[model samples]
Target chain A: MIDEIIGLYNYWVVIFLMMTGFYVVIASTNLVKKIIGLNIFQTSVFILYITMGKVADGTAPILEEGITSYSNPLPHVLILTAIVVGVATTAVGLALVVRIKEAYDTIEEDEIHDQDDSL
Target chain B: MDNLAVIQVLLPLLSAPLCLLFNKARLAWMIAVVVSWAALFVSLSLLVMVNDNGPIIYEQGGWPAPIGIVYHVDILTAFVLLIVTSIAAVVMPYAGKSVEKEIPVSKQPAFFSALLLCMAGLLGIVSTGDAFNVFVFLEISSLATYALLSQGKDRRSLTSTFQYLIMGTIGGTFILIGIGLIYMKTGTLNMADLADRLPAVFDSRTVHASFAFLTVGICLKLALFPLHLWLPNAYTYAPSVVTIFVAATSTKVAVYMLLRFSFTVFGVDLVFAKLPLTEVLLPLAIVGILVGSLAAIKQSNIKRMLAYSSVAQIGYMILGISFVSASGLTGGILHLFNHAIIKAALFMALGAVAYQIGSTHIDALKGLAKKMPWTFAGFAIGGLSIIGVPLTAGFVSKWYLVLAAIEKEWWIVVAVLLVGSLLAVIYIWRVVEVAYFQTADDESDIQVKEAPLQLLIPLWILVIANIYFGINTSLTVESASSAATMLLGANS
Candidate 1:
């Protein structure tokens, strides 16, 4: 029982983080907080990919004279690309928040809804 | 010549940055027009090549598949490529005049650049064989769409853009997770490789979870029914040109993604037989059709009404898929093409109205037929297509859908299809009545003039296409059935 729990703990943590990030995105009213939630969710997915690539006693994916064991490098490269995409999304999200603040004088979702409704 | 598929995507991508170098709006518009038409020409040739020679597979950087990215040009990809590039071509000429009036001169060049980038991203999504590459291009198109939406004149567009940004990012992240899970199980990201390896592990819990994630994630992106909260507002407030392009292409590409994954990657037995996905999809699609048409009937603004109508049309595509027959898949794919042309024409006509009267409220369309006869004729024909009137492209797809349902003895589904078309009739007649029967209110002093020749030319192009494709069923029907056979034949 203990062995099974320990073996799958990384995925459990990934699920926990994913659920929390998803919850924050749904529950929060603040636009910046929603963006932060999105980042957390994406980072957790990155971790999920990286965790799956791990090998027992594996070192960094580098070539050497004697070393034969290496963690998978493809997922790492994919995550690097994903991180760049995540950063671009964040930058655009923040720029949009700035525009929203200028247009409506508030960044809270409910407040924005109220204002739009009044219009 | 062998790298023509690569050039189809590369042409638009490379032109985007070049558009940024131009300061004059006219120069930028000209660049966008020329590049988009070139892309269309390339797409048409690719379609012909695939039709005659079968599928063409091009490897990136001279690397083979399962190691590096590959551009797989199958019949489905070629067909969607034609739809997307053709819409981009038709919309660009209209975009020049629409943007000139709506957006400031300084912002026009960047707007065109963003549009080209969006087009490149969409074409890339349809062409690439790598699973992760879809997510990357999905984000590229999404971010560009957000920028395009923010260019709307109404301040409310800022909020709508933000809403779509949040939802779209969540969708993208979910897709990434799904891809990671699939990679974990099979150790491959190439879709063809994954299809080969997945069947051995089809019964695993992880595989099932991954399928769920991918379905939900793609459902969000395609604005399927209940998850479609961001679409009406995004379409309603966006500048008409942006609405026309995205309305015609974005969700349609997402539907193609769903088809690719469900039939090609997951296999029919796993998605349709081993699981109860079709059961869930059918009911939701029925509700989406009924509710979308009902909501569209109540909307006072013309753009919002059309946006709601798009939600319902997506439901028709989903309904066709859930039937899980060769004829049904053909119906779905045909709808993908037919809807693109029909909606593009409808939105362009509405755009012409907005250009002339500066609003898309049904009231603004009052007596519009008297002033803009060509534009209203386009709208009236497009509206008939939406209602699935005989001898229109819309009827072609709906006929296949109804036949598929009847073949399966799904009597209730047939009823839903007929009722949905009837609802479409009511909403379309509402607009036609306002445009033709009612007189314009004399107080506003709005000039009664026709749209410019630039907008009219493209608008009629799509309107003519709707009629031409409806009359000639050889191209759409043959390609759709072949694509369906290819997708289903892979599984059996």
Candidate 2:
């Protein structure tokens, strides 16, 4: 039973971080906070991918004279691409926040909703 | 011929950068029109090739399937490609004129570039057989869509785009996590290989969790019922041209993705039989149908009304899938095609109204039939199709859905389907009555001229397609059934 607990600890951490980030995105009203939450959420996913690629006693994926055991490199490569996508999403989300601030003069969701409702 | 699938995606992707090279708006518009038409022609040839020969698989870098990215063009891909490219082709002409009036002159060239990028991303999503590649193309389309949505004249569009950005990114991250979990278990990102290996781990809790994550994430992206909070505002406040393209293609491609994942990757026995996805999906779909149609009845803005109607139309598509029968899958796939043409035409007609009157408020459409007769005609025809009137494209798909429901002996679903259509009649009739019967409150507004030839021609093309495809089911019905069979048969 203890071994099972130890075996899946990485996934437990992943789930914890994911839910926390998701909660912040849902519960926070500040636009910047929400974007930060999104980044955190995406970052947790990156960790999940990277953790899954790790192999015990495995060396770097690069081939050497005697090394036959190496960690899987595919997930690392995939996560790199995902990180780029995350950055692009962050850039756009922040740009939209800037535009939203200009238009409504506030970045709070409740205030924006109130202002839009009045109009 | 194998390279044709690659060209379908590359044509628009290559043209987008070329669009940036043009300083003149007219040149940019010309480039967009020509390239979109080329995409249409390429997709048409692909459809014919797939219809005659079978699925076309193009391996990138000439590497084998397990190691290299592959573009897989089966009947399903070809059908969706036809819908996406045809909408792009028809929307481009209208976009040139619409952007001139709605966007600043200096922003026009960049607008076309973004539009082509959005198209290429959507095309990429539908064609690729690689799971990780789907995420790459999904973000490409999504980021471009955010830019397009923010271009609306209303300041509210900025907020709407932000809301979509937040929701879309979360959904995307969830999808990535799901793919990650699946990869952890199976160690392959190739979809067919994943399918081959998945049944071995079908009972794993992680696999189930991955399925749950993927379904919810995609539902959020496609705006399914409870997850649909972002769609109405995104459609309502977007520039009319953007609404015309995204409304018709984006969510439908998400539906295609859902179908692809459930049937192609996870297999039918696992998704439909072992899991209670149908039990969950059926209730949500039925509620979505009634709630969407009922909510649409309350909207005063025509654009928001149609946006709600889109939610209900998507409900019908999901309801068909929930039945898990050959006829049901056929109905769902058919609705994907039918709804694309119908909604695009209706939204384009609304764009025409907005261009002339500067608003899509139902009141603004009063006596519009007298002034913009052709546009109203397009609206009327498209609206009838939405109501599932006989001899229209909508009827064909709804007929299959009702038949599938009867096959399952599900009486409540049949009743819900009928009630949804009845509500569609109410909402559409409200517009028809306002446009045709009531006199304009301001007499001077009635003197507004017809929409430009560019807009009218595309609008009529889709309006005519709505009628043509309704009568001639040879293409749509055959492709949908063949695709459905392939999906179900692949798993067994």
> What is the alpha-carbon lDDT of model 2 when measured against the actual structure?
0.93
* lDDT on C-alpha atoms for all candidate structures: 0.92, 0.93
lDDT tens digits by residue: candidate 1, B1-492 = 659989999988998888889667888899999999999999989989999999889999999999989999899999999999999999999999998778999999899999999999999999998999999999889999999998999998888888899899898888888898999999999999999999999999999989989999999999998999999999999999999999999999999999999999999987898988899789989999999999999999989999999999999999988988999999999999999999999999999988988899988788889889999999999999988988999999999999999999999999999999999999999999998899988835757799999899999999999999899999999999999989989878
- Docking level for model 2: medium
Give the per-residue lDDT of model 1 (tens digit) for A1-119. 88768998887888888888899999999999999998888888988998999989999999987989999999999999999999999999999999999988999999998988812
Pairs of residues clashing in candidate 2: none
- In order, the interface RMSDs are 1.6, 1.6
- Total backbone collisions, model 1: 0
lDDT of 1 at B280: 78
Candidate 2 clashes: the total is 0
Per-chain TM-score of chain A in candidate 1 equals 0.93
**A10-101 in candidate 2: lDDT tens per residue?**
87788788888889999999999999988888988998999999999898999899998999999999999999999999998999899999
- The list of candidate 1 runs beyond 4 A from truth reads none
